[model samples]
Target: PPGFVSLVGAGPGDAGLLTRRGAERLRTADVVLYDALVDPAVLALAPSAHRFHVGKRAGRPSVSQRAIERLLVRAARAGKRVVRLKCGDPFVFGRGGEEALALAAAGVPFEVVPGVSSAVAAPALAGIPVTHRGTSAAFAVVAGHAEASYGPVLDGLAPGTLSLVVLMGVGERAGIAARLRARGWAAETPAALVLGASGELVHTWRGRLADLPGLALPPDRTHLPGTLVVGAVAALSLRSPHSTEAQPAARADARPT
Candidate 1:
């Protein structure tokens, strides 16, 4: 019998956010290669599978991308049902596309099971909608893992763009804010940092764009993955009144047009 691979999105950080299809793939996996940030509960879904950690983080040792692709091909060719579990939508900067292409080139059977991206979920979980009727109607999502990659996105961004969502950006928050300001973005533009989104330890910080560089995380969580949101909507939180998450205060100062 032949084997197959499924690139499953694990969602932001909560196991509950895993899609029905993603869950189904995990339940049938004979071998699971999961990212570093996948929640433990999600891994529990594949109890009988042989699990391997192939997650990557900034400043930490990680399995190389090429190596991971090779592993997937080898596993499938060996007649094992493989699962490449990723956090968030695999295609949303999760490198799922690269892996998929590698599998195709190798003639290995594989499929992508999309998951919720933290770019949108992080802001929503923090009570900030990326778009609102009058507040904002357009947005851009960019990866902040490298300045070379994100610098062009920031430079090409229109002055009137309403919202910007950044993933893997905490380490470069200061540089990003500086570039946005240099591009004529107002210092007082609303901004937010949502850490550990959709998880029990989630925390949100909100203030003017200028305040981003000054915002600090707990020493322990300094390297925690985060989503950075900028523009007027960052100051709005539509979470239920009973929601315990700290909501951003509505901006009293008018945002720049």
Candidate 2:
């Protein structure tokens, strides 16, 4: 009989956010297959487990998803408890479901342990409330990577009513804003780019939707992670001690004519 597999959420870069349940799974894991974003410190927690790095860096070559699947199945056949760690919540576009499906088809036993996903975690760590009374009533999370069509899901936003949070949206900023504007989202909506959230190098730059695409940014690409929060709640972040606090009012900064 094959040993079990556990798909674990490693949270955003900070190990402080690892779920207690995830840690327990790691302790029992015979081998740990972890993501690119998991902190090395957290990886140390499972010192006795055989560690395999299956990280996917932006713009860099990475292991094929099929190979990752084979690795998990091979380990399970060896009767090793395998933990497939991923950054952020496994259910939120982390593609954990696909892996689970693969494992199920192969007859592997597995468990899922949730962790704080960076979608909400990075925004909160930046003092930006994703939802607030009288500010944003609903929120949408999107991916920044190119699509089969126009690129990132920012096109789904209706424009003014809800807060929008985007992960992996660091690229193609200008085009994203253009599409959102064409879709009717106000160019005046306040937005921010917060990089390296929850760690010592955390940084944030606030801008109106029109200006966000052109804002100066940090040099780190794939290694430095970020979360973008937009809408009225974007304004409220100024009240927090850690917020950069110099954002222009959303309505005042409409897209240039």
For 81-131, candidate 1 gives per-residue lDDT tens digits of 999999999999989989999999999999889998998888887778899
Q: Could you report the Cα RMSD, in angstroms, for every candidate shown?
A: 5.5, 6.7
lDDT of 2 by residue, 1-257 (tens): 56999999998867778889888888888999888878887898798899998888867888888899999999998999999999888887788999999999999988888878888878877668788878878888887656433443556556777888878777756767777887887878898888877665677778898898777686664357877777878766523333233321121222333
Q: How many backbone clashes does candidate 2 have?
A: 0
- Candidate 2 local Cα displacement, residue 116, angstroms: 0.7
lDDT for position 238 in model 2 = 29
- Backbone clashes counted, model 1: 0
For each candidate, what is the lDDT? 0.87, 0.78
Best by lDDT: 1
Pairs in clash, predicted candidate 1? none
